[model samples]
Target: MTPRELIDVADVPGGPPLRLFRRGGDFMIVLERNELMSTRMHGSEVALGTMACDRLAGRPAAHLLIGGYGMGFTLRAVLGRLGADARVTVVELVPGIIAWARGPMAAVTDGCLDDPRVTVEMGDVAATIGRATATFDAILLDVDNGPDGLTRPANNGLYGNQGLADARKALRPGGVLAVWSASSDPAFARQLQRAGFAVETVRVRARENGKGAMHVIWFATKR
Candidate 1:
């Protein structure tokens, strides 16, 4: 077996963490002793973001909230697809994720954070959403492993019934909320419906190579 090569490093809250590294030609982002994300699996994230934005294609001055800043793939894709008048608020739980993007994974982002329309919030995405008014045009949640909550234990509540209710109240009338999951959760879809969102599920290809797990994205619209 061939070992992955180290390319660059980043700083987390506790210590100096590996940020970017190239194994052959692929780049990966390491966070807190874990490879948080890699370029090899970026397509699925971008696809989820794009599908969410697609539901709002004709809207002007749309306000979007993105949960998670892993490698900035979701942010970059939304920025590219949105109109100039659209505003994006990205809420990341870890400040180190932003540092990794600015320092090591800068190329992937293409300076999207510097855009005047983009606001970077260094905090938990759920807390950010809780404080906001019902002013968002769309909400994209890519945090954790999905409704199962793999990355952070506390993240489980984000997909719970109450969490879904909060997200519904945070969106404007007819607003869209999209969630990316590693797999399907039938209970989650039921919760979305209970919160008054018309829901739809999409299956996406795992990687740019077009082979891997079949990821699910749940698109819900406020009623």
Candidate 2:
């Protein structure tokens, strides 16, 4: 069995650094010692985009904000499901991750970064949500594991009461906020409701073919 080799690292502010490793043809991103994402396991990530995009399917004015560009799986999935007129703004805190997508992970990304409907921003996604004023139709976040599972101290605010409020403000009326998580958190769901969002929790397979661990995705609609 071939062992994973450390290929690159991205230094994050107020958080653990991101480590990139490659083994054979597969790649994985980790924070500290815990794996953040893997090229081989992307089912939940794909669903994060597709499910959110599906909610805004008929809307011609669809504009999406995707937080965290891990492996570009969610970005690519959302792009394929959205219309040409739709716009996707992806915010990634670690610039190196984006570079890795274009460099080592090009095959998986499929050049989605350079697509006409997409915009890439190297910054904090939490800040981006706060800056927007009813700007997006859907805001998807797959960062820092989940609300309860915080890999970084800085990411805590994103799942906090104020952060959820900011996300609510960023979305247009009836806009959706989708968050991908490794596991379900009842408290997080309650927090979403407290922030005036109509929330629905869905349990999905880790693999697209329904063959892996059950992952959680929250669908919170701005009310």
Candidate 3:
């Protein structure tokens, strides 16, 4: 197999670093120091993000925080589901990934950045969450592959007991924290429990083509 080429890198506030690269036709974003986001066929990323958005039902002027901006799939999915009163804040660590989404992958995103309801927070999601005064109705985190934190060691904190507890504090009562993972993680689920969240795991197909690896999403609700 041919070696993957490094394209560009960017910095984030809290430490899960950002590095964007291309391998042949595939584009990848390395968070912390490893690949945190990638595009497989054409629409798997959007699909996974959509799975999280699908659970966001209601019309309470929802506020959402998306951790990663990989090709803007999750942002696009959220926009499709949200009403005009809803607001979405996308916190992306990598400037290059945002640039790539506006540049090479613009067609896929379909002007999501320019949408009036969307706000782009170009920093570590943890920083924004820690500082935000308002609580969100939903927090969809797809920044890392799973709870183990392969992209960056610091990301493990988000999946750990304290991190999950912080997330619960960030949300409004009964608000949901939807996390997408490359695989199922029982320990992370336990951590969510310890954080005082009602958690549910959903297994999903990885590829838009309907045939690929199986992925998991942990939907944890704050009560």
Maximum-lDDT candidate: 2
Residue-level lDDT tens digits of model 3 in 4-75: 887776665445557777777777776655556667642445665566566666746889888887777778
Judged by TM-score relative to the true structure, which candidate is superior, 1 or 2? 2
Give one digit per residue, the lDDT tens place, for model 1 in 102-150. 8666787689899999999887777877776787999999876678555
Task: Tell me which residue pairs clash in candidate 1.
Answer: none
Off by over 4 Å in 3: 1-26, 30-36, 42-44
lDDT of 2 by residue, 47-70 (tens): 999999888757896999999888
Minimum summed lDDT over a 10-residue window in model 2 is located at 144-153
TM-score of each: 0.88, 0.97, 0.84
Model 2's TM-score against the true structure? 0.97
Report clash pairs, candidate 2: none
The runs of at least 3 residues in candidate 1 whose Cα sits more than 4 Å from the true structure, single-residue gaps closed, are 6-21, 30-36
- For all candidates in order, the CA lDDT equals 0.80, 0.89, 0.76
Candidates ranked by TM-score: 2, 1, 3
